[model samples]
Target: MHAPPAPPEADMLRDALELAPDARVRPLSREPLGSGSVTGLEVTDPRGTAEPGTRTTGVTYFVDTSRRAVERETGFATGPSEAPDARVWLHPADPHLPALAPVAFADAASVLLARLGLAQSGPPVFVAYRPGRRGVVRVPTATGDAWIKVLPPSRIAQIVGIHSAFAHAGIPLPAIHGWSQDGLLVLAPAAGAPVAEALGDAEALLDEVDALRRRIAAVAVTHEARTGLKRRLDWYASRLGEYDAAFGALERRVRAAWREAAPTTVIHGDLHFGQLFQDDDGRLTGVIDVDTAGIGVPADDTAAFLAHAVASAVLTPAPRDGQVWALARAALRRWDDEAGRAQGFRARAATHLLGHALGAAEMREDERAAALLRAAASVIDQPAGTLGAT
Candidate 1:
């Protein structure tokens, strides 16, 4: 996928910060915070200014430049109400929206990890940064490299609990070494590259996904944990007003095909090739980004895998009619049959693809949403058996 758009006001803000009179403060990454309304521009300073109210281990010299930039660019003051540490700033262009402070929060994550005894003395390297949601960093530890995941404070317990439960269940997840009072979660490095980078033969890929499906099914959640997938679809459809008619038709189709007999299991709500990692030997190494995992229809994971493959193949600049699509059809066939004894599996999968399309549309990614819409149509319009009949 292409990189996220750079914030328009970032260059001027970088020049205005004046953190170091001689050294240049450059923008590292611009992440969208809170529904694309707020933009976070992570900047670096040579003067080594510590962020105000950061009382943790180690010293992080990069100040939260976003706060100052936002206040100056847009006359709204982001007082103490946004966050306890005031680690948030209003969007520079839009006065109403709020975002994470334009500091590499990963630096703070590193310090949090050190206190938890997960890392040693060196500065942490940025592994991934998604503004307003999470910032992941990698730190060198005495044992090996450990990853620090910094997310919202409210979900910390849920994430830690999920990790513990998954580990006890023998699922192939990274070992959770420790967690901090703050929202930082420290984990051992996952074993392989994402499937987007390492696409094995179609057969091997399908086999690996099958293994993951089985592991998810092994987890026994209570009935209260189960939630209907339709609820999620409704949320997306409501947000995409332009696609209301199309989503209405899809909703009807899904309701007609919906079967109460379908077994509910632990499902990765946002399963996709990018979420999957596999070893060089084509074995499923482990699954990352399990924050979205919960109870849902078992076939939902298979649907997600298929939907992502379809979207990627169609949206890429150099699209390929790859064999993975054929394999995806085969995977769907198995779960579809087990759940409803017919094409009910494909129905659920189609519904998910449609939901994805609506989501893309809401993001104003017209081309992407259009591609996903067409992809979903192809699946929904055709008979399930015809998927790989050719």
Candidate 2:
């Protein structure tokens, strides 16, 4: 199936950037940012660079779709100019995330690295970035590698405190080397390979997760983190329905199955194989990105982990796909047998799966989004006990 048409803002952005008429504009990624959206693009000029004949390779650019946001933080809108009435602005200058430009660019980031006692050897490589929210950049340091987390200034203290609490409680989270006033947090790299790279025994992995959950429960913190997915169901439904009407029916079923559980324990708001790492001995040794670590329902974490496993099975390519599918099946069976409320657990898992589908749709990954939507439907249609039976 053909992907959804690019937003009209894309053309305006191309004009603002002043690319050749035949420049190839491909979307790298996209996500919702407050009142609108943020899209990352790769523009390749057919006419080539300063040298003749050789085509210009892709150049990255970000575009924000909210005029109100651009107006609110006009000082940060430092990219190419748009027409006075345009709703979008090309960004290195995200309105809500002023820290992004400095950290994403090498020269300015070097100053921040100096403060953390690290020398920048090369340009910062963005590990992850969510337009107006937070970003993680991998920086090459004199000693080795360090990661800089760019967050809203107000969130720095809360995240730092959470890291400290987790470390004091013996969780193997990354060590905070230092932080700057503008919300650049320098972190020592965590040890071990991500579980996504080397998924060992599924049951053994769960054992470690359960143990970690218990330890997290005992650690005290002031923040209360919740998934907030329940509140955003309508938004996801609406956005997805723009691509396919079936998403509307899917949302109804998910809402009907939803049940609010009391926040009983401290849980990782976003738990998945990617967030976990295991040592050479196949032991869970490192847990990174605890930004959402605080009070929450245990099932949210359980469902998140399971949902990601299933999504990976659907999206992962080739030989590794079979192995991941096996892992997903094992995880589903284990969680289903152990869950106190099987139906509720399935409902929550389906909700998480739909979230993955929404992200795929936003990125214009049509086929992948359709597959994920099917995965979600299966989760909702089958009994938890029989979900992974196939």
Candidate 3:
């Protein structure tokens, strides 16, 4: 059963801080971080949205400079005072999320340590960034790393789906071991460079993920076979009759355009520059995270790309000024060459336009979505034939 909603002020970090023997509870910053900040979901995620759940760990450590204080602050150091077969450790956050206070602080601290290459491994290497407590962990064993990713046994099917999809596609993603009884998904060792750090060597990295994506696409079922949930256009249209109507109209136009182009395989739902990872030796190692993996109109992913490009564009009315074409061309090359040359430049082109149009409209991005619609509208009025035409 799904967990019930939590209280709006359920301050897990403050509670953990108060519970900790020596750690100090610092209040959060009054100003909240913006939506598009480099900070991750932990900071961005507001409190009360989280369900009440406790993860299991045989050990916990409090990070500090003084050994005696660390021992005192971190709990269960081989004494009778330790809970029956349970141990607690005092873990401190280096830079807490000021808006969310203690939790953010701990999360930031952990991320800093991970990026710096500290506690990258331990026996049961699990890193839970819930609220408060620890800042980074360098586990001693791979076993711990595996335990860190434990998931539910029922979701093994989803795990199996991701694993088989990777194997069939011949991509190198994290391996999925069976889940422990506690429902945590055990995973094989992951060794790769973070995608953000790999940006300097983009050309090579793009080629790598492109090849991997095709392999993924190869095993993908067609759109007709993958119905229900929400179609590319339907997602936009459904929201049209609600809080806004622009989204629905845009969805209709994008749908018409999509029908003119045929889609063949499933595309990675969130494929982008940040998704790729590499090894220390500069080898492109794996594609991480495929929970949204499924057969989709390539244009769906394409739309997300366009959204990012436009949103990040330095100038407005990019299409008129020719910048849109320039960026689109670059994205097309990556989609074409790196994306395994799927042979649908014309259809994909139309879909790309449609994707952006529909998305902007749905988002009620009044000006941008309208502009995209006008761009498509300016070029053609009626779609000529059944989709997937040459």
Candidate 4:
């Protein structure tokens, strides 16, 4: 298990950016894009003229193997220089996400925030940005914090309708303040601490999640959500196999054991502790990021929660790791007991674990990735009622 080699063009892209002689560029995050990757970089300048609090500037680069994709994209600006193996495109002007260019800056973002009757209290902090797909920006308001979700303009109505459906069904989701035709949706802050921080009583957490899932299922939504990790098992295997042959074998085992299930009910397509919030009293207070809420299998939500719990236990620090592991074991035992009755629960859980393994490997967290791979294998190899017997 070693760190993946740095992208061949990272240095070339850094030099092309033309920063101060003393400036340094460090990789912050990486996600797979079309035949290449979208990398987030932290550029630090010793001269101290960078973003507040952190004396570093954040930049995004899209490196693609396809020259046609680079040349045909007229939405974003590209660097003057090019890499030998891949084409490098810069941001603030992401071709796929048109709203990013305006929202990336303060003046432009403030002008957009004005539409919701809110003034920007500080520089917008991008909580998450997935190159061409979507971006979540945290905007500070005088009263409290608000979130601006940037999506493709075509998705605005569909997402707004989903939020409306969830609210009608009495789900504790973030309140939508306002939305624009250009894909910026302003939302009131979600309540309580993330479940990741306040994790306790695994059974109790499961109980709340069960109730939440039932409420979600009752909501009548027309849009059918895409299948979860089971559909991407082959893709994950292919990406991981590029690094090591063992992953190819692991994928074969997973595919042989996996039993695909039909989409039967409405679900929080991406359910994990991070997306859930609990109040001081340790009750489920809010659930954010309904971007994937629609019709899907019930097991997709359960497996998502289980896989993330196991991954967190594996990746987190000592004392917390022990606590999360205990929770995961308890939850796994419960799911294992039900696996006999639930058609594809075990297989779906394994697929989700493998997805996390791929993510860990992509980030060059090889040890964590290997541990997760083992976890996924265990889920598959262990008999129906003995998943957490160890």
lDDT of each: 0.56, 0.73, 0.39, 0.72
Candidate 3 structure lDDT: 0.39
Per-residue lDDT tens digits for candidate 3, residues 1-390, read 011232122233334323323333222211111111011111222222233443212222222211121212233322243212122233332122111222123353244334434343423222444222212122343233432332323344564566676667677767754433323333455557765453444346546655766677876433232222233334334333343444445445544534333455776665654456777665667775554567665654554443333333312433443443334335545554333224332333433444455445433455665555444443223231211111
Writing each residue's lDDT as its tens digit, candidate 2 over 1-390 gives 245676565686666655677778887666555555667777788665444553345666666654333324533243344422333333456555557777888888888888777888888898887766788899898887889898877678888989888989888998788986677788988888888988777778888887877888887885677477665565567667777855677888878777777787788788888888888877888888888888887777877888898899887787787767676666666666544354366678888887788788767778888888877877765754444334
Candidate 2 lDDT at 128 equals 85
> What is the lDDT ranking, best to worst?
2, 4, 1, 3
lDDT: which candidate is best?
2
Score every model by TM-score: 0.64, 0.82, 0.42, 0.80
Better of 1 and 3 by TM-score: 1
Measured with C-alpha atoms, the lDDT of residue 334 in candidate 3 is 54
User: After superposition, which runs of candidate 4 have C-alpha atoms over 4 Å from their true positions?
Assistant: 2-59, 64-88, 337-342, 383-390
Better of 3 and 4 by TM-score: 4
Q: Sort by TM-score, best first: what order?
A: 2, 4, 1, 3
Q: Please give, for residues 193-303, the per-residue lDDT of candidate 4 as tens digits.
A: 888887888788888888898899999797887554644665666567766666766777777766656678898888888888998777899998888888877777877
C-alpha displacement of 340 in model 2, angstroms?
Answer: 5.3
Per-residue lDDT of candidate 1, residues 89-193 (tens digit): 322222221222321344654555666676565656766654445666677777777776776655677877777667777877888877754465778877787
- lDDT for model 2 comes to 0.73
